[model samples]
Target: MAEWIYEDGIGEARAALIEDGVIVAAEIEADDDGIAAGTIAEGRLVKITVPGRRGLVRLDGGEEVQIEPLPRGVTEGGRLVVEIRRAALPEPGRAKLALARQASPEAGIAQGPTLIERLHASGDAVRRLMAHEADALEAAGWSELLEEARTGEVAFPGGGLRLSLTPAMTLIDVDGWLDPAALSIAGAEAAARMIVRHGIGGSIGIDLPTAGSKAARQAAAEAVDTIVPQPFERTAVNGFGFLQIVRRRLRASLPERLQGDPLGSAARALLRRAERTPGSGMRTISSHPGVIGRIADRPDWQAELARRIGAPIALRPDARLAISGGHVDAENP
Candidate 1:
């Protein structure tokens, strides 16, 4: 059975869709400092890098947006209403904003809690995530899922596929299959599921196992479309077994952020592990320096952990700890 777990912490929030006690989809809600995708705002063109082409705009609150095809009559110093297509990611040297679409004069900005809203209204058991949920999350392969999302690789029955995100589109390369036809059939299904699992959107190119006939190719494309959500288009698998899928992208795919800040994800998981430990007083969490650094960047998170557990936390930086694996034990504050 599938269930929803919504963890509302002091400084961070996460929603997980767990099927058969395993998480199949998840979203991390940002704190105040994070720039979330899907924010619509009024922006003033600050500069015209390429006149009448793409230029930069300073939105309300001093945030810059990348606006292209400058709206008619709009010039440098003019206003351009826009919506955020991609988040201003925290990655180093990642300051450019990606635009999604233009907003109407009457349009009002609205931001929703990513997947958390859906899980809250779902029929599945929805509860605040607790320490006990860790076992279920682990049993459902939380760590493995995090690793897979970080690596952009998924393996199914006959073969596996690696997802590559390009400036133009997201590509899925199928490999390591014994039967080409079976690989196409199964790969199509697997690819679709992975796309949804990672909250991927926009253009996706799936290079399936080359089949012997066009009919077989068409069948594979049809199979893929059956599971995809609405407002999507797909091309028939071509001679090269390349099928292009176009999905509506409203915000930055969760996978992108996860891949960019894996250390943060690991630290969050470690906190979850500590929260669920049966008997706990003040706890000592020793983690890899990488994860420790990420955790230290968020004093709010440390305070939240302490508040939630009703005890202080002592963080020890351990150079020998493996990635995503940390030591948690009770200790005096």
Candidate 2:
């Protein structure tokens, strides 16, 4: 049965839509993700970056975001209301500012819908998961799905895809030992699945094996249509076996989160595993120093883990371990 599995984890909320026992779509909402999309706030116009076109606004909470269509006569230092269009996106070295537009003066201040709320609003059966519930997310290949996003690798029958994120767009390069015609079709299908699974948006380019004939290219395009849902635009496969797709990007994708904050991502994953580890008494979480540092910086998360598992929690930084190579060990009190 198709359903959404939701978990309010230690540092983040997660949801996965399962169809035929496979994850077709998923989302991870970090607790620290600032002002979600659709939030309306009053802020001061701190700077007129683009004069009449755009500017920067500092919300009452002190977060600065880029606002478009700088309302007529609204100059620097002016107070105005704006609705968030998208949350800030985390990147490797820096983060993109959240996007907003002027809001009606009479609009009521509101927070955006949460991941679980969105799932319920979808009218699909949503099953809230608990720590002791057999780990339905993992059983549905959540870890493997995350690895694929982190590594940008997805394998199919005849070929595999190598996805790379760039400033302008995400690129998917297909490679394998299949024939040109067959490989293009297979690659397109795989790329489409990856796009939907990861919630990849904005611009995307897929490079498939060059088609031997125009018919082959059409077949490849048809393959993509079979998997990806509507509300997107794509170009027909060009002679160079390239296709471009554009989707509305309202928030950061899975890859952006995992790659943008490696230490935090690893730390949270370690904490989740620790919470689920079966034992009593004290539990020790051992990981790379950076990950341990990240966890240490968030004592609240550690306390929550301890509270949930009914045990004392300890952290040990091992220089020899990789960031994601953390393990939990239960010790006698």
Candidate 3:
């Protein structure tokens, strides 16, 4: 049976769906993910950007979001309850605001369900992991999966996929030593698996090896269908071997979270390592200066880590080390 292995790490909550001892899907919910979808809150209409179609709202917490289908009688400065449809997405230069719509007053103000709650709702067996227990997550290639998201590189049997995130959509290029027909089939399947694993949604463009025959193109498209379960729409493979897919996007994908905020991701990863470090007295975390700075900026996270491990935590900055090259050392007192 497929199971979800869950860990409540210091700064993030992680879950991995394991089937046959391999991770098929994964999710990471950081503490800073603002105004998650399904959240119901009261906010004041701040500005009417699109007249009656859309407007901006300022929540009680001072975060602004875009709301659509403005109520007929509600004008600027009117207070109303809103339900978040999509959480804010972090991008390279600018972040997208959360999207919401007016909600009934009966909905009441409530926070969104957490990562663990959503997993439990899936009807799958969930195993909550403790830090002191054997590292089941690591054994399931959690670190390797994370590296793939950070770099957007996935290697399969016959070829590899290079995924690039664009403002319009995610573009995937397949390349390998195999022949065009075989490579197209293999690459399509591999790309599909990566999309599900990374929780990637929205628009996607897959560029496979150009197939000369219509039958070859159909085979490649079928390969993708077999891997990715539906609720998505896809265009038929064209003569040039290009296929496009559209999926419902409610939040940022794993790649976006890791790539958009490298220092925060690295800092949280380092804390996870520190929590699991054995024979700890004063655990020292050594990493790039930027990562160390990120951790230092959040003293609450450090205190939480120290509390969980029952040991003091120290930060050691090494400018020469790569961002993801951080390590944890437990002092023997």
Candidate 4:
């Protein structure tokens, strides 16, 4: 059969297939949504079946249809019958970047087997995997991470909805068996939204606080949809009193990959030396991004180290801390 082509910026466009001056099938292309993401073209095939006919008919309704063959000649019985249907579209999923490649042992990029190459090869899989992983982490849950770190367990205020979050700040709490709580739909929704925006990656457990009232549970579930700025996957409440949420993990957490390790190492060394010196009257402390129920439970600098450093030592909840010019204050506590 002969093929036809037509391009329109509107909804998906397709043209009926023509063979020997007779219509047979239609071809389809996805239309542009007119967004910055650009138009998507998904290949589609629709059969345009005509009664008693052995071919198809060409339709201009932006769809494809195939037909069957019939007796020769044109008439009311010869008129082409068309039924347009859409074909399957490609599934949308994660995307990632490429990575650098490793060199072989014998044929190294350097001169012979001993020299070095000015550049490095790339690994598309590694790059792509890293990129997708980072994205997934960011969308997972940020506030949940923070909440868990702070209190060991944070209840799922959304009632049943899951949370999404950015990469850095996560809010979550410790986990334990608990009854679901009774909360208004509005309250549940607010909690859900907050959870998604602040908590991206890491583990998060939401305790509903009580269970028993169907209205409360329903309200919480509705809140999840209300708070979400975007759609989510793997977000569902379990039979237990917990709301199970798995957001995409983005890149490494702020405390994990970004913070300069050298500086932290140096600070710890300074503290250690101070601690051993004795009578230094100095103290130092460092903290990651969590606030605990007790001061002692919070990470602290050894008294000896603080004395050697020539001042009080401390770590803040925000993970950044320092001492200079007499006073040191930061986000950590």
Consecutive 10-residue window with the lowest summed lDDT within model 2 = 324-333
Writing each residue's lDDT as its tens digit, candidate 2 over 1-333 gives: 789999999999989999988999999999888989989998999999987798999999899999998899788899999999999998988999999999987899888788888889989999999999899889889999889988999999998999998999999999988999999998999999999999999999999999889999999999888888888999999999999999888889999899888888899889889988887889999999999999999989989998999998999999999977999998852
Candidate 2 stretches greater than 4 Å from native: none
User: After TM-score superposition, what is the CA distance of residue 273 in candidate 4 from its true location, in Å?
Assistant: 24
lDDT of 4 by residue, 204-295 (tens): 44444444666666666666666644445434444343554545432222222112122332333233233333333323334333221122
- Superior candidate under TM-score, 2 versus 4: 2
- Root-mean-square deviation per candidate: 3.0, 1.3, 1.6, 25.4
Task: List runs of model 1 lying over 4 Å from the truth.
Answer: 1-3, 9-11, 19-24, 89-101, 109-115, 118-127, 131-136
For model 2, the local distance difference test gives 0.92
Off by over 4 Å in 4: 1-194, 202-204, 253-333
Q: In candidate 3, what are the lDDT values of residues 47-90, reduced to their tens digit? A: 99998799999999888999998877889999999999888987
The deviation in Å at residue 225 for candidate 1 is 1.0
Query: What overall lDDT goes with each candidate model?
Result: 0.73, 0.92, 0.92, 0.32
Worst 10 residues of 1 by lDDT: 87-96
Using TM-score as the yardstick, the better of models 1 and 4 is 1
